[model samples]
Structures are given as structure tokens and as C-alpha cells.
Target chain A: SQQGEEDPQALSIQEGENATMNCSYKTSINNLQWYRQNSGRGLVHLILIRSNEREKHSGRLRVTLDTSKKSSSLLITASRAADTASYFCATDRRNTGGFKTIFGAGTRLFVKA
Target chain B: DVKVTQSSRYLVKRTGEKVFLECVQDMDHENMFWYRQDPGLGLRLIYFSYDVKMKEKGDIPEGYSVSREKKERFSLILESASTNQTSMYLCASSFQTGVSTEAFFGQGTRLTVV
Candidate 1:
């Protein structure tokens, strides 16, 4: 079973607009990570936030984790046409041996130019 | 930079034929994983290894078997390839055993079983 489920299965916006995607998980996690994938390509690591941290940022990307709610959100500011891709949230729960990151269904974002 | 490389970008196999998908990481990371991605199912874990000669079953491991004879390499095997087994296979590598470990991925291999 998937440990996380991403919201807004799909989203579309014009370039320069902000894109926000949310993910909810079922179990307690030690940290959460966000990833981006271009069409038919490998996934690129975007950012990771520990359970103790509330927010993290990298370039135009911002991520927030709310352990109380077992949820997290990723925001991409000033979206570009090149930013079109699928975003996924992976959970690394405590007690898992190693590299046991469970991924969500993912949110497909389309940035129109 | 960490690099995870897959043996092929695409593959084609016949039903009932044994198939092998190979992955190698340059960083000597102790952890490696194999996942299959489908349309709505997202990415489902098939198998993973924490060290040389070690393997563990993931969420969906019924049709897959894995080998890790070398620390830098992991191999996923399909005992008998079936059409339903065709999908995008992904390989990843990570450094440690904690939640904060970041995984590096390969470009993926699209397999087609006929």
C-alpha cells in the first residue's frame, strides 16, 4: 500500500503562476521528501524536510510538513513552462530499515506558456 | 555527484522468458531499490538491498526477485516475464538507513513483454 496520497491528481496553470500540491500520509514518518519527474524521465530529488522541521526552501520551491496532520505541501513559485512535470511525496517512516521511501500517487502539474 | 545507472533505457522480452534488469551506482551507497511505475498506481516498490548479498521484499514483490552480490550493483529479476509485467522500471540508491537519506535515481527502463 502507498504510505502517502497526493491531492489534486492534476493541476494546470500559466507560466509565472504559483503551483501548490499537497500530500497526506497514513503513518508516522521521520521525514518527508518531494520529487519531480519530467515525462518518461527519472525522478529528480527536490527537497527533504524532517519531522522536526516545519518548512524548507530551495530556489523557487518551498515545502512544509505538518506532522500533526500527517500531511505536507509543496509550492513552486513563478512556475515555468519547463516546470511541467509530475510531483511526488515520499515518506520515510521510523523503524524502516533503509531507503524505504514509500511514494504517493503523485500530482501532475502542467505549466502553460 | 551521485550517479545511478541502469543497464538499458528500453527492453523487450517474450512471455515466460526470464528477464534481468541491472542497476549500478557509482557512489558505493549501501542501499539500492527497484520500483515499477504504472499509470495510476504511481511507483510501487519491488525490491531493495541494504548491502552486498542482502535483499528485502517491498510493497509489491510477488513477480520480482533481486540480487545484490556487489555493494555497488543491484539486479532485479523476473522469473518468468509476462505481459502484465511490462512497465517502467526504476533503480535508486541511497546512503544510509534513516528517514533523511536522499535517494538518487537512474533514467529508468521501459520494458515491453510480448
Candidate 2:
């Protein structure tokens, strides 16, 4: 089953604008991660935020997690036209006895230069 | 750098034929997974192996089986291919650190069943 569901099935913005994508999960998660996929390629890991961590940042990517609300958001600052791709949020369910990563349907971001 | 390599970037097979998709990881990770990505389905886990010779089913494991005889290699087998099974297959590997770690994915295999 898909644990995470990303909001805004699609988003389009100017290259200099910031893009935000939100994801909501069904159950408690050990950690939430964001990935980016370009066209027909595989996904590339972006950032991961643990449940105990309210916010985390890497480069221009900032991820915020709200355990109580069961949602997380990814914000890309000063987006570029090269950032046009699909973004996915994944959740690792807590205490499943095994490691299983569930992914969401994903949000397609189109950046216009 | 951790690298996961899928055997093929594209494959074409006939319906009812047995198909095997091979994946190899160079990082010696303990966990390997198979997922299928469709148009609107995102990604659905098919199977995962935590250790050599041990396997577990994921959300969608009906027409698929897995083999992990070696630490670096994992294979996904389709008993009988069908047109419905045509999708992008992704293989990933991650460390078994008791906590969920980052996963490295291959380029994916675009399988077409006709």
C-alpha cells in the first residue's frame, strides 16, 4: 500500500520562484524522504528528515516534518529551469520489523525560464 | 559511490513467457527491493530481501517472485508475462542499519510485454 500522498498533483512556476510540495502519510513513520526523477530516469535521493526532527536542510532544499499532523513539506528555494521533474515523497513506516519504503504518486514540477 | 545496476534498460518479451530482471549492487548493502512504476500508480513495492536467502513480500507481489542467493545480486522473476505487467521496474539497495537509510536506485528497466 502507498503510505504517502503528495499534494498538488502538478505545479508550474518561474525559475526564480520557490516551489513547495507537501506529503501526507497514513501511519507513523520512522523517517520521510524526498526524491527527484528526471524524465524517464530513476529517482535520486534528495533529503531525509527523521520523525524527531522538525526541520532539515541541505543546500537549497528544506524539509519540514510534522508528526502530529502526519505531513511533511519540501521547499526548493530559487528554483531553476533544470529543476523541472517529478518529485516523490517516501515514508518508512515505524516498527514494521523489516525495512519497507513506500512512495507516493508524486508531484510534477515544471519550471519556466 | 554506491551503484545499483540493472541488467537491461529496455526489454521486450512475449506474453506467457517467463521473464527475469537482474539487479546488482556494488555497495554490499543488506537490503534490496523491487518496485514497479506505472503512469499514475507511482511506485509499488513488489518484494524485498533483507538478507541472503531471505525474502519478504511487499504490497504487490502477486505475479512476481524474488531470489537473493548472493549478497550483491537480487533477481525479480515474472512467472508469466502479460501486457498488464508492462511497466518501469526499479531496483534499489540500502544498508540494514536497523533504521531506514538512503537507497540507491538503478536506471530502471522498461519492460514491454506483448
Candidate 3:
């Protein structure tokens, strides 16, 4: 079963706009991470925010986590055509004796030029 | 830099044929994973290996099996390929650094079954 579910299955915005993507999960997690995929290729890790931290920033990317609500959001400050891709949120949780990471279906963002 | 390499970037096979997908990570990570990505289904875990000669089933493990004879290599095998099994296969590895350490992925293999 999938642990995280991303909101706004798809989003479209003009260049230079800010894009926000939300993810909600069902269970507790040690951390939440976001990734980007171009077309159908492999994933690129963006940011990882631990449960102890509520917010983190890397360059123009800002991520916020609300463990109480089991939700997280990713904010792209300045969008560009190059930013167009599929974004996914993943939750890392303890399972059995090890850890398992579950990824959300993802949000397709299109930054029009 | 850690590198996870998949044997093939694209593959084609006939239905009912045996298929093998190989992955190797040079970072000496303890955990390795195999995931299949589809159009709307996102990435689904097929199998995971925490150590050499150990493996575990993921959510969708019906048509796939895995082998981890060495710590740096993980192989995903399809006993008999089917049309539905064709998808983008990704390999990843992560160290047991702490809570929620990052995972690095390979270039991915796109398999097409006809």
C-alpha cells in the first residue's frame, strides 16, 4: 500500500510563478523527502526534512512538514520551463525490523514559458 | 560520489520469456531496492535487500523475484515476463545512516514486453 498521497494531481503555471505541492500520509514517519523526475527517467532527490524539523530550505526550494496532520508541502519559489517535471513525496517509516520508504503517486507540474 | 548503475537503459522481450535486471551500487550501502514505475501508479516497490543473501517482498511482488548475493549488487528476475510487467525499473541504495537517510537511484531501465 502507498503511504503518501500527493494533492493536485497536476498543476500548470506561467514561468517565474511559485508552485506549491502538497503530500499527505497515513502513518507516522521519521522523515519526509521529495524527488523530481524528468519524463520517465530516474528520480532526483531534492530535499529531506526530518520529523524533528518543521521546515527546511535549499536554494529556492522550501519544504514544510506537519507531523500532527501527517502532511508536507514543497514550495518552488521561482518556476521556470526547466522546472517542469513530476514531483513526488516519500515517507520513511520503521517496518518490521528495518526501514521502508513509500512514495506518493506524484504531482505533474508544468511551467509554461 | 555514490553511483547506482543499471545494466540496461532499455529492453524488449517477448511474453513468457525469462528476464533479468541487474543493479550495482559502489557506495557499499546496506540497503538496496527495486521499484517499477508506471504511468499513473507512480513507483511501486517490488523487492528489497538489507544485506547480502537476504531479501524481502515489497507491496507488488507477484511477478518478480530478487537476488542479493553480494552487498553491492542486487538483481531482479522475472520468471516469466508478461505484458503487464513491462515498465520502468529503477534501482536504489541507501545507507542505514540514521532515521530517513537519503536514497540514490540509477538511470532506470525501460522494459517493453510484446
Candidate 4:
């Protein structure tokens, strides 16, 4: 079963606009990671934020994690047409012996030029 | 750079046929994972291996079996392919066991069972 859920199944934004996607998980996690998938391709690792950390940034991507709320958000600043793709948030949950990472349903973002 | 590669980009097989999906990684990662992606169901884990000759069942592993005979190669096997099994299969590798670690994924293979 999936441990996380992402809001806004799909989003459309004009170029240069900022896009935000949110994800919520069910259990305690050691960290949360965001991924991007292009059409018919595999997922690309975007950024990872540990539970102890609150915010992280990579290039134009920003990820914020609130362990207290059990939720995380991904923000893309100055979006471009090439940034259009599916975004997924994966949660690493502390289980019995080893941890398992569960992925959410994902949000599809379309950046119109 | 770490490179994860899948054997095929697309495949078509008849129902009841045995199918094999191969994945290879050059980064000498310790963990490998198999996931199937559908329209709205997102990506569901089928199997994973932490080391050579060791495998673990993921959330949806009933119809799939995995083999990790080598450190750099992982294979997913379907004993009898069914029409419902037609979906995109993705392979990924990671270097660490913790949740904070990042994973590298292959391009994925679209399989069609007819």
C-alpha cells in the first residue's frame, strides 16, 4: 500500500509562473524525496529532505518538509515548458527491521509556453 | 554518473507466457527495486533486493518473482503474463538502506500482454 498522497491530480501553469505541489504521508518517516518523470521515461530524483531538516533547495526547485504535520511541498520557481512533467513524493517509513519507501499518486504539471 | 538501464523499451507477449524483465546498474549499488506503473494507481512496488541472491516481496508481489544473482543485475520474472499485467515496469537502484538516500531509475519498459 502507498503511504503518501499528493494533492491536485493535475495542474496547468503559464511559463514563468511558480508551481506548487503538496504531499501528505500516513506514518513517521526518516526523510521525504521528490521525483520528476518525463513522458514515457523513468523517474528522476529531484531533491531529498531529511526529517530533521525543514527546507531544501536545488536549482529552481524548492522542497519543504514539516515532520510535525507529516506533509511536504515542492515548489518550482519560474517554471518553463520543459519543466512540464509528473511529480511524485516518496516517503521513507520506519518499519520493522528495514525501512521502505512508498510513493504517492503523483501530480501532473503542465507548463504552457 | 550512475547509469541504470533496462533491456527493452517495449515488449509484447501473449497471455500465459513467461516474461522476463532485466535491469542493470553500473554504480555498484546495494539495493535494486521493481515497480509497475499504471494510469491512476501510480507506481506499485513488485519486488526488491538488498544484496545478491537476497530478495524481498514488496506491496504487490503476488504475480512477480525477482532474481538478483549478480550485484549489478536484477531481473523480474512473471510466470504467466496476463492482460492485466500490461503496464510500465520500472527498475531502480540505490546505494543506501535508509529512507534519506536517493535512488536512480531506468527509462522503463512498456509491456503489453495480448
lDDT of each: 0.91, 0.93, 0.92, 0.91
- Which residue window of length 10 is worst by lDDT in model 4 chain A? A92-101
Candidate 2 docks at the CAPRI level of medium
When summed lDDT is taken over every stretch of 10 residues in candidate 4 chain B, the lowest stretch is B94-103
Candidate 3: the clashing residue pairs are none
* lDDT tens per residue, model 2, A1-113: 79999989999999999999999999988889999999899999999899899999999899999999999999999999999999999988543446688899999999999
Clashing pairs in 4: none
Candidate by candidate, in order, the iRMS in Å equals 1.6, 1.4, 1.3, 1.7
Question: Which pairs in model 1 have colliding backbones?
Answer: none
lDDT of 3 by residue, B1-114 (tens): 889999999999999999999999999999899999988888888888888988888899998999999999999999999999989999999987656678899999999999
Cα lDDT tens digits, model 1, A1-113, are: 99999999999999999999999999888889999999999899999998899999999999999999999999999999999999999997443456587899899999999
What digit string (tens of lDDT, one per residue) describes model 3 on residues A12-104? 999999999999999888889999999967898999999889999999999999999999999998899999999999997675537877788
Look at candidate 3 and tell me the lDDT of residue A107.
Answer: 98
lDDT of 4 by residue, B1-114 (tens): 999999999999999999999999999988888999998888888887878998878899988899999999999999999999999999998876655479899999999999
Q: Is candidate 1 or candidate 4 better by DockQ?
A: 1
What are the per-model DockQ values? 0.74, 0.73, 0.68, 0.70
Best by DockQ: 1
Candidate 3 lDDT for residue B39? 82
Which window of 10 residues has the lowest lDDT sum in candidate 3 chain A? A93-102
Candidate 3 lands at a TM-score of 0.97
